[model samples]
Target chain A: MKAVLPDDLCKIFSKAGSSGSWHKYLKVGDWLVLLLSCALVVSSYTLLWRGGVADRAIVKRDGQTIIEISLNSARKTRVEGPLGTTVIEVQPGRARVFSDPGPRQYCVQQGWLTRAGAVAICAPNHITLELNGRGEASYDSLGY
Target chain B: MTPSGIELPITEDDRRIARYTAAAIALTVAEAALPSPLPGIKPGLANIIVLVVLLRYGWRDAAWVSLLRVVAGSLVIGQLFAPGFFLALAGAVSSLAALFLAVQLPRRWFGAVTISLLAAFAHIGGQLLLARLWLVPHDGVFYLAPLFATAALIFGTINGLIAARLIRQVETI
Candidate 1:
């Protein structure tokens, strides 16, 4: 066998060819750690997703006056608007709304917004649904 | 027993692989065993070994050890495909790149501690990017905190010191 040179950095490389201690230490970039964190956050979010829709309804007329109602139970809610009442149901996947007072039932078609910055709004009825899964209020009641 | 009272006996090839694998496994165990300040922030003690890997071994070898560490670490932690595992993987990949560059520089130029610190910073940056992509996209910026930054500095320095010490010891041996 050819003698391994002490300064031969390639010796480290060759060691990896089999399976042995070539070096005493190693350094890896933070990228992998960051990726793992992202994965963890996403997984945690998935679990929170199954907690079901956290029912929150906000009613507004002409975008100025507003009244809000929060459902403690996992039940659906219906809010009365100036023109007519709007039925809002909260489910696991998405939040549904029923009312034809506006040009587009934007709120009705708006799918689930699970995380913090997710918001669904209806123009005509002036209603908004904001889902806060990690909210303090939700935790105080029981859990979100 | 091996000469010089060192444990284990092996040929050149065996010694090389063993050291590499030992470093990887040690890092993985450190990662799992050590506690993070927050669930979001970990000390990343493993990166020290990674730095040593990149400097002593070629990038390809370093990559292999990193891959094994992620897979094995995840499996052991049972957090596979979870956010933590991906975060760790990101750090490893970025640090690997940093080390590849560091290795190119003359060994006598920059000390191992300096390289370790750079690798740690790279790991943090990778994590930030991954957060923006997968997790709270808008709030991803929130992931960067002083606590984590401090942890990186402290742990990075520690790893660097350890690497320097190991290098000296290896020379004497």
Candidate 2:
């Protein structure tokens, strides 16, 4: 095997401390502004974003618990069901079935799960997602 | 009764603001031609002029130029009294308020770039608040905050750099 040289590895970090033009433009206070913007972005993602949308989401397969997710972070979670893989996409306060291998694609067409008691059921795949929250909820299933 | 209209006096500041307003309006019209991937995101190139006037002239001149630009720009776009017009108004008012305080900071530490960043963030913040309250009427608007904030950081710094460069060029002349 050929020996890997140290000179090649050092090339990767050559641009690290060149003190690019940004250094010349940003002042002491400008750094504060940048940090403030970052804080605002993080706060928007974490706080009060779910006060009205939802609180949590439960993904189940055939009446068995798969996983429970909080509605506070954006993610694309894949769950293995009977038929195939089902992809669930989540925003800060809402969840949706992004894609699924189900034949009818009913759950995917339901779009975002915003309010409480909203459920997206991929029956063919045996995957069901139920949104539970404190917001205004609509009666979905009938037991009477 | 005499039908002749009474003459009102126009000061040099008025003329200067008129000129700056025209420049800002022209930038807004030109910006409208550019394609935007999102509804609230834009280059906001006119801010360079605002920062320039803020430093070159003073707060009063800059304030006049900014507020007039909003009203006049909307009029030209034919969106007078429309919801979009109010969004622009809120942005202008918030940015102007930010500048009013930013300009008072010690020049030794804070500079044009910082001021520009402050104004841009404030502008988007005001627009977002107003939009959530009146337009979308939902918390979904908060989901877009990060995207808008990132845009503010990028464009604010670029516009600040441009304004700094323009100030140097103009001063040397």
Candidate 3:
């Protein structure tokens, strides 16, 4: 049974019979590439170590001034009203927004913006916060 | 029984095909290892090896080596059925087709690098077409600039030089 596949079709399945061999010459350029890949992987992991998101807040219209609720106050402190209940984890320096009335709920799913310069803004309710620092707590108004 | 029906040459042809196949795999692996900032842009380094094969060896050998490269390289990158793998395969096939045509021209006329550039362009064209059909159909044309400037020229030139050098070595052997 001799079935000759077309050249193009055969090419797609020819891996089993064709692997190239190379001499073991340690080129300086190859070494540089190894170092660079390692550096990129290490830097990304270092940036994520020890800290998840620390805190989150939702600002709702309360007549005059904007009111901020601390997400890390207590696990039991749940907010319920006309606006949907947003369960958040407020850490030392970071705040993770759970839900918001926005076009894309992408920000809410990105649990706990813990890294410095991380932010979640709900423009519909005029709520904003700058997530900063590591797991260290900075003094802010935590109570009504 | 197989597509290359000339019952596996046991002499010089076998040696030639084997050598070309090995070189193609090595180059493909190297290209696959490179960091791709975007989905499509590659230095096109493997084209250099393909160019050498096309110039020194016959088109048949070059075609065989190129085919194996796409298959093996895709598996290594863990992108076997992905769009990127098919893009690369199509590009390689198109590039090889271009190179074969270039080789049919007067050998003394076109340089290896010139042929390489043509091949590189063909590969890019294939990717763009696939992107239009499979990916964002509306904005596929937007992919040309960055791919040409950053990926094509940079890797194509590198591959050209490598091909030029290998041709010299193969001649001596």
Candidate 4:
């Protein structure tokens, strides 16, 4: 006795059998897009690396620039935002969100920021800190 | 298998949608359960169902399956109405749009792999845009774009090959 194939499986098999040639599916246009995407990724990273080191850290709260601190100086400041307060610390060419009034404390968990365009954001408190260096800022900021 | 051997009222399209959605949702949940080494990098195995649907059916069916997967997957992962949900929704919308446009290109010129790549890029791009506008609100967010793009390239190709192989297996059956 022949075993009966499931309907869904049968559908896939029959459909695939009747479909057009699979060998010719990829063409020059597809290759072009793939190559361009790869190039874009590579060039963007190269540009990021070339952005050099940052010397300043800018603090912002609720879309407003709060203060700019030189990374050369080690200091700490508190910024108030909608959610609450965030303590920002800058030390020897690097900065970080020392503490924030949030449950997760994500900004604090981001550790340190030393890159030219690295950022630490406390979304709940609407606070953002960005690093700036001697060289030009690379493609905006890294989005997660 | 019904009591009276009677056919179900569901149409073929409906059945296909249900089957593909189930597959995508399973993949999504499994992916979520796994620990990702990086923040935005995942294998995106769910995309295989979308690619297969697009190839066997059409964009309309594929869109339904993809969007349903995002919504249901988010719900399953308990992320509904959260920032993550919104980001996932945005990614789904953009990827579907990308797939729609990619489908317009001649099939011979672009296969599952190319379409997957475009969709993956669009997905990451959408998430980044949403993150900048709402979540982080910093230009620094774009710094992660290259990393996300690299992940997309790798996952997209792998998923595309899996879909292609499945399609070939189905044909052989």
Query: B45-107, model 1: which lDDT tens digit per residue?
Result: 656555566666667766776777777767877888999889878878888888777667655
iRMS per model in Å: 11.3, 15.2, 13.6, 4.3
The numbered model that scores best in DockQ is: 4
Task: State the lDDT at A117 in candidate 4.
Answer: 78
Task: Report lDDT per candidate.
Answer: 0.59, 0.80, 0.57, 0.82
Please give, as one word, the docking class of candidate 1: incorrect
What share of the reference contacts is kept in model 2?
0.43
The TM-score values for the models, in the order shown, are 0.50, 0.68, 0.49, 0.65
Local accuracy of candidate 1 as per-residue lDDT tens digits, A1-144: 223323333343344333334233332433334344445446545554434445454444556535444544444666776657777665554354654366777877775454443566776766666555434434222110
Scoring only the A-chain of each prediction against the true A-chain gives TM-scores of 0.47, 0.58, 0.34, 0.60
Model 3 chain B worst lDDT window (10 residues):
B140-149
In the range B26-135, model 4's lDDT, one tens digit per residue, is: 88999998898876678889899898888889999999999899999989999888998898888889999999998888876677788889899999999999989999
- Model 4: lDDT equals 0.82
DockQ of each: 0.04, 0.19, 0.02, 0.24
- Candidate 2 docking class: incorrect
Displacement of the residue B113 alpha carbon in candidate 1, Å = 1.5
Q: Provide the DockQ value for model 1.
A: 0.04
After superposition, the stretches of candidate 4 with alpha carbons farther than 4 Å from their true spots are A1-29, A52-144, B1-9
Candidate 2 lDDT over residue span B1-173, tens digit each: 87669877898777667776777788888987899888879988878778888988999889988888888988998877999889999999999999999999887677788889889999999999999899888656766777788788889888988777656545544
Give candidate 1's error at residue A78 in angstroms. 37
